[model samples]
Structure formats: structure tokens, C-alpha cells
Target: MAKHARPGRIDPTWPDLPDGEHPVSELAAATQGSLSPFGDVEFPLDDVPYVHPVTEINR
Candidate 1:
């Protein structure tokens, strides 16, 4: 049922797994920060500005 089964969808699980000892390797030093989704290259956690809703009823 997954879209990867169809012709061009390459399942990047095994191949994509970073090379080196787990927990020991930081990955950035090995791959040269190629994998954006893995480390600091990833999108920063959004600090969404808080805006309280105005609940005052109009007279």
C-alpha cells in the first residue's frame, strides 16, 4: 500500500542509514552535513509567537 512499491520510489532505509558506530558517530563529520533531516541542518524548532484570542463581545 506504500507509494515506494511503485516503480521509482526508492526505499532509503538500509542505504540511507549513516555509516559508523551508532551513538558514537555524530554523522555530520562523516556525511559532511548532506542529510538535512538528520542533524543541525534540519529546520529549527519553530517558536510560534503566542497571540491570545480577543473574547470581548461588541456592545
Candidate 2:
């Protein structure tokens, strides 16, 4: 028998819809040129502590 799917649940066989209607797709499009966790987009480079070159490290 086929299993029923519902909101807040995951289904392995979900079909891909057009970008306009897909939740993740729409989010990606919205942040296409900006920094977003869901994307590999980079932020405007200026000065960020964590990203700075490692100057000192203990052995």
C-alpha cells in the first residue's frame, strides 16, 4: 500500500516542481546574489576576524 504524506514530514519520493513553487528554490532565487547560509555565496569582503589569515597558532 502507498503511504500518505503530510506537512512537516519528509517523503523520499517527493517530485521536483518549478522553481517558482519550490520552497528552497524560491529562497535560493531570492538570495541569488547575496550571502545566505543555504548558498555558497560570499559576503562582501572587508575584514572579518574568523576569516582572517591565521597569524598565531600553538603547536
Candidate 3:
């Protein structure tokens, strides 16, 4: 029988991601360029110190 997947847990099948520290503004600027500027999406850049990755998901 197959085991049930648990909530708030990553599946074993998924690739492992390396953890590292980085400034939020740098990350935001890097990703924002992926979107079309003409579209209705915006990610304004701000110079801030390091932000935790887990907490950034909620933003």
C-alpha cells in the first residue's frame, strides 16, 4: 500500500533545494524581470537586509 502524503511537508519525489541566505530586494529584482512589465503585475525593489526564505512565501 502507498503511504499518504502529509500537509506542510515536501514529497520525497520532489528535488531537494539548497538553502542559502540572500537579500529580499535582490531576489525580488531577479524574479520580477521574468514577468511582462506591460502586464498588471508589479514587484517593486527595496533595499533591505536578509529575509528568511520560509517567511518570504507568504509575501
Compare the candidates by TM-score and give the number of the best one. Answer: 2
Sort order, TM-score high to low: 2, 1, 3
Alpha-carbon shift of residue 12 in model 1 (angstroms): 7.2
Model 1 shows how many backbone clashes? 0
Greater TM-score among 1 and 3 belongs to 1
Using lDDT as the yardstick, the better of models 1 and 2 is 2
lDDT by residue for model 3 (1-59), tens: 99897776966666555677443434655554455644654446365556766744665
Residues 6-59 of candidate 1 have per-residue lDDT tens digits of: 645655453443666454344535565345544564355577466889899999
Model 1 lDDT vs. the true structure? 0.54
TM-score of decoy 3: 0.17
Compute each candidate's TM-score over C-alphas. 0.20, 0.24, 0.17
Worst 10 residues of 1 by lDDT: 21-30
Residue 29 accuracy (lDDT) in model 3: 58
Which candidate achieves the best lDDT against the true structure?
Answer: 2
lDDT ranking from best candidate downward: 2, 3, 1
